[model samples]
Target chain A: MNPPTPRPQPIGRLAEATGLKVPTIRYYEQIGLLPSPPRSQGNRRLYPDSAIARLRFIRHARELGFEIESIRQLLDMADHPDQSCADADSIARRHLADIQSKIARLTALGEEVSQMIAGCRQSSVRQCRVIQVLADHGQCLGEHLAGSVKINEK
Target chain B: MNPPTPRPQPIGRLAEATGLKVPTIRYYEQIGLLPSPPRSQGNRRLYPDSAIARLRFIRHARELGFEIESIRQLLDMADHPDQSCADADSIARRHLADIQSKIARLTALGEEVSQMIAGCRQSSVRQCRVIQVLADHGQCLGEHLAGSVKINEK
Candidate 1:
């Protein structure tokens, strides 16, 4: 007897099963992270059961702070299970290093800001320590910490 | 006699003096962080000398990781130098707290990633520790950390 075909799930069910939003699922398909699934007779997207494992992998990597590009490479490695894990190991290492660098930078910033606040006497703006330091970063202990704050938002 | 009219600086000179790119300067204006400058007879922007100090303040605040909304409020406080510094102090305190929180999060992420890499044996993908942890987050000690890695980029 032939093996029974796996049941196909609708897009909403896929989103629910994966803890991913409907839009996020569509976005993943658009980005080619999730391959286009076969559509239903009514043109609804129907995902095979395997998509759960794949989406979970993507979500898990994202939580671990992996960049999309790195995740893409890792996914590719996952697809070809026989490939050496050196590339995956390297990608994780690089991400760890990047995280460490950011921690160091942010720690310095936190120190400077703390110092600025510590010096404040709750006085008028004319003599506010916080304003003074922000207005002239020269007063900051780590003037070298100057850079775009955009890192935390991206 | 009235004070001599402040020298007007062209867009290029303003950019040079402030270390702000011309597009950034224009963007600041467009976003209302900067007031629109009067045009010269040739319809070129003519920024007053005061723009230098203003832009410097914005740059300093940005470097310190103040969000645009907070910077707007701080700028208002700076404008009214006679106002009590309670708002500025609170903003600085809040920012300091935020930086510390991010440090905590990133520090945890760094440790987890480091551990994942450490456990990796540089073996075949089938036995890769990193892949195992990523594919099955159940293997991770902190399974709750599954969230966006976009914090570091921001």
Candidate 2:
């Protein structure tokens, strides 16, 4: 005979098992990344073993910096095990390229800021290189930060 | 006698001069980065010459990735030119460190993704290295992206 079905888990238990916050799991469901699970008589969500695997896949993908949409595509491919893995490979490659470009931009920005600080005389604000360069963009070494580079917030 | 007062310009002119969108200019005003300008008889916002300089300062600081609050502090320091520029130096130093850290994190993440893609045999989804590593975190090279890394959205 076939093995007995594994008991379904409540949302809390599923969250604990998946190492995802409850809100994040809910958000995934809201965003349609996670399928809506069957609910119990008391209206609590009940997840089966497959749900556990799916959530783990999402969490690990997120941890790896996969965007939500990419995670959705990956999930779709995972569900259809017979399909070719070309899309998955392409997505990973694209992500790697994106990360590399960001690294380049940040490196340039870091150098500019570093140089600005290095040139600071630490005298009055009027003579401060940091303030002077910021006040007059013409003083910048280059237009390295001309676009929407994600400079860190204080 | 002092030079003739520079004629006041409207919001649109200010936007054109600063290369900032109208909504962005309004947002800066709302956030108190740009002080509210007096309105004309028709209720059009009229900005003085001093406003142009202040808006440019805000725009440059934002392009360099300074947070709004930090810009406010910088503006205060700029207004008081006699004060020591130690705060500006410190802020630039901190931002430089932040960018450096992000570069390191992104570099690690890129390597992991690169390795994952490299190892992929381009076979069926069932055996795909990209999918496999995402499904199981244990397969990752390291915990480089375990936290809130800003992976790009598709």
Candidate 3:
């Protein structure tokens, strides 16, 4: 009978499986997001199949815009597979709301930017609509949008 | 008998007009983006109508997503009132291009995020499409989206 092929074990295999760099995996370990794996005879980190699955989970959550802290919470909740998914749903819902708010803000900014560009279509710097608008704070409808509302009186 | 209404100089007037707070205005000045104004009696900063115009221009440019460095370049070009409008047009056009690029990138991100959400519709974490997708980096199509690319790798 042919001998069974030996499987590659440890950090290299885990890195390849998860599409995460080795350093990043180490960093996640350092940050306490990922549990420490077992070591081989030479002290090289050895991760089982479960580690690959967890790393992939973390990567995907990140892609969907979940912050590191939020992912940590989600990971904790996910550990108890039999638990109600109400917490996961809530997290996802909150993320959706946040995305919606960002879209709204960026949309408003886009409109304002378009208008400013339009103003400069035909003028000289002396009469440049772009310059004129920037110089006159009153001309901005989105004064509050510039930053905070703390008005500084000199 | 005639009554006199006193006029405060440019710095004071700019602070009142822009709501930018004096220190912020000074910060802008220190950056060499804004030119030092002439001083009046008692060595107080004296600003002209042009200064107000400049301040407004800076504020508007900032709103439109022009960085301070770009704004400085534009201001320099604008200083020569008789210069051709071509330079100003180029600056505005470049800014517009930058905005368009950002919007395109964000739109791609939005699509990816939405899909991730759709995949997880009511599924348990063990069977969650969101988790599955995140765990598998190969499933993503946003390879060119720089910010998203760095999220899990680092």
Candidate 4:
């Protein structure tokens, strides 16, 4: 177990402790996802040890495919640990729905793209099935979105 | 179809033609993804008829989930229509593989989130299954990643 190295650490140390880049930590603060930590006498940002858990919570939420705005709401909900989690549940449900829809669209695209590649026999562009399929969406066999697939992967 | 208007239209018309935003057309030009079009005597951008095909191709490639860099390669290949499509095929195959991996990850996350939602009975945050599932990775039931799910929606 790491000895409690004298409470607060610099922003860089905080980043290192959380496996997050320095810029990302600052960006989180800038976006109000993370509260601004106190500053040292030399104008250096000093974050308390508690920041680690907060940052980790945000990071973990992001890894679970929650969008930034959804994470903000989740963070807010988590702040009031004793309140009802109905909002949290709703947010999770919405995120889950979005992920499912994206998966469905991607799965269909995967099949169509796979078929396009398989159909192509390393021929010239003139005879390239992949090119033809992309050039004309009507050639696709799947119902996957050829004109629109609303997804924001971040 | 209506008769073609006098040779060149403004950037707005170009955006309308391709269903791209005005700024996005500018961004494409800035990124060298789309070639700069000729300007009129008043310094307004004037795209020739060929620009429509070029922009549509870029948009279609994007809808197919090809990354910007892959789209660049595809565009370059399209420039030389007489060339073999081996590169295009490889790019499409690579993109297809990426999309497949992403779908797999999202599917796992979707299930976990759904379970968290299903297990919840609209309880308080203290006893909230969804919050517990997110806050503590060990609560996950499936082999899905609780600490990591690499995907972005946009």
Candidate 5:
């Protein structure tokens, strides 16, 4: 008789293969980011190879700084194979722009920080240039924190 | 008679000058980040020029992404004018290294994201290269993750 074919993965094996901890995998399932896998006779979760792939995709997207909501949309798009990737491109472009803006803001902030530290000059609190510059709002040449303003509006 | 000198700031004006809301300014005073200013006849808080300068210094340090604790240290150092600036320099260098490391990590992540997006050819889910790449953990070459490892020892 032919040898019996190997069975598919159990939950623990799948977690090990995917480098995801067991609890995190369960959390993903609980959050609906992952589907509930079938159960074996012992009531243990049994995951197919497909589940491993999906988990990998989620992990990669998260690394790219895609928010959970954005990842959800990407996954939904992936479910429909024949769809165009215009949405994906747009999302990626937007994320890139966001990153660029953040870099710009941080760069400007670095300059201001450097100046403040320079102003300290080991002076007494009464004569500290750092304190003087901060008190004068006009000394701040960068943007007036428009992003925080929007958050406050909410 | 000599002309009347300008009066020192009241709490409300100090808050406006420092870009801190009134409640936050009061909270700082409560927490000792700011000193309790003298009170007016109606019991309103009154601040002198030194107090205003301190508020400005705190605000600027915050903008530089210095933690409240670090700012407290810097302020303490500033209180003693005659000390060496070595402590201040060390703090700034540490903060600079942190920023540089974050930028490096983000840049690496951005490259990975660009690759993932580039791999998408708008094909059906069954034929989606992006999905294929995401689903397999062994295929990932980047070390991207949502959470950081804490190095606290028991």
Candidate 6:
């Protein structure tokens, strides 16, 4: 006799199995990242076993800082196992480049802030190098740190 | 006769002088970073020359990646020139530490992504290390990248 079909797990079980918040799992569905799961008789969301792997993949990618759009492309590529992985390679490489660029900028920022703090004498605010350097951008090491470079708000 | 009073400049001139967008200037005022400027006879905003210096200071602090709250503290310190600069020093040090931590996290992420791409042979997605590593978290270098460590989403 054929084996009985595996039971579909509820959304909470999927969230537990994948280490993703329930809202995040729902959000992934809303964004079309995850397929809409079938519902039970009571109208509760039920996810197939395969949902665990897919959600885990999405969570891993997000942990590594991939944007939602990029994650969408990655998931699409993942769905087709026989397809060439050149697109995935490109996305990963581009993301790596972005990570490296952020590291470099943060390095520069760290150095500049370090220098300002080091130059401080703990004296009055008027003589504080930190305040002085901030007041006069011309005194900065370079203008590269001037505009769009923002530290992660989190 | 007393010297003539200096004419207040319009919002556009303040924007031009600070290299900050008009909305950003208005945002600073909305957030109390900049004092509200007097309106002209035609109801256009007219800022005193002092606004330029104040705005420049805010811009520089922001360019250095200081938080709005931190900038508020620094501005408060700057306003009181006779105060000790210990607070400014502490803020800079803390910011520097935060930048360093981000640099370290990004470095690790870059390495992991680089290794994944290097292991890929341009083959099918089924054999792709990028996909394999993402699909199976157990195959990753470590669990540290599995949570909160996000590459700058920008």
Candidate number of the best TM-score: 6
| Residue range B29-107, candidate 4, lDDT tens digits | 9999888988888888998887877887777677778888988988888777789999999999899989988887877
State the lDDT of candidate 3 residue by residue for A1-154, as single tens digits: 8787545458877888777789989989999899998888888887767888888888767756688988898888778666655667677667767666555555665666566667775646776665556556567557656664222210
Alpha carbon lDDT at B124, candidate 1: 87
Q: In candidate 3, what are the lDDT values of residues B59-135, reduced to their tens digit?
A: 66675667788889788877876666666666766776766555555566667766766766565677765555565
DockQ, every prediction: 0.61, 0.61, 0.31, 0.51, 0.28, 0.65
Task: List, residue by residue over A43-128, the lDDT tens digit for candidate 4.
Answer: 99989877887887776677677889988888787778789999989999898888988887788778888988999988788778
**Shift of residue A2 alpha carbon in model 1, Å:** 10
On DockQ, the stronger of 2 and 6 is 6
Model 4 chain A: ten consecutive residues of lowest lDDT: A145-154
For candidate 2, lDDT tens digit of each residue in A74-134?
A: 9999888789999999999988988888788778778878889999999999988988888
Which runs of model 4 end up more than 4 angstroms from their true locations?
A1-18, A35-49, A142-154, B1-13, B142-154
lDDT score for residue B4 of model 2: 98
Candidate lDDT scores, in order, read 0.84, 0.84, 0.68, 0.80, 0.67, 0.87
By DockQ, who's the top model here? 6
Ranking by TM-score: 6, 1, 2, 4, 5, 3
Clash-forming residue pairs, model 4: A151-B153, A152-B153, A152-B154, A153-B152, A153-B153, A153-B154, A154-B152, A154-B153
lDDT of 5 by residue, A44-127 (tens): 888878888788777667666677777787788777767766676667667766665555555665666566667666545555
- Residues B7-32, candidate 2, lDDT per residue (tens digit)? 89999999999888888899888988
* The candidate that achieves the highest lDDT relative to the unseen native structure: 6
For model 5, the stretches where C-alpha displacement exceeds 4 angstroms are: A1-15, A37-49, A111-154, B1-14, B22-32, B35-51, B118-133, B136-154
Candidate 4 DockQ vs. native:
0.51
Clash count for each candidate, listed in order shown: 7, 0, 8, 8, 7, 0
**Candidate 3, number of clashes:** 8
Candidate 3 off by > 4 Å: A1-23, A36-50, A118-124, A137-154, B1-17, B21-30, B34-56, B115-124, B136-154
lDDT score for residue B5 of model 1:
79
TM-score of 6: 0.92
TM-score of chain A of 6: 0.89
Interface RMSD of each: 2.9, 3.5, 5.5, 2.6, 5.7, 2.8
Candidate number that wins on TM-score, 5 or 6: 6
- Among all windows of 10 consecutive residues in model 5 chain B, the one with the lowest summed lDDT is B145-154
Chain B TM-scores, listed for every candidate in order, come to 0.89, 0.88, 0.75, 0.89, 0.77, 0.90
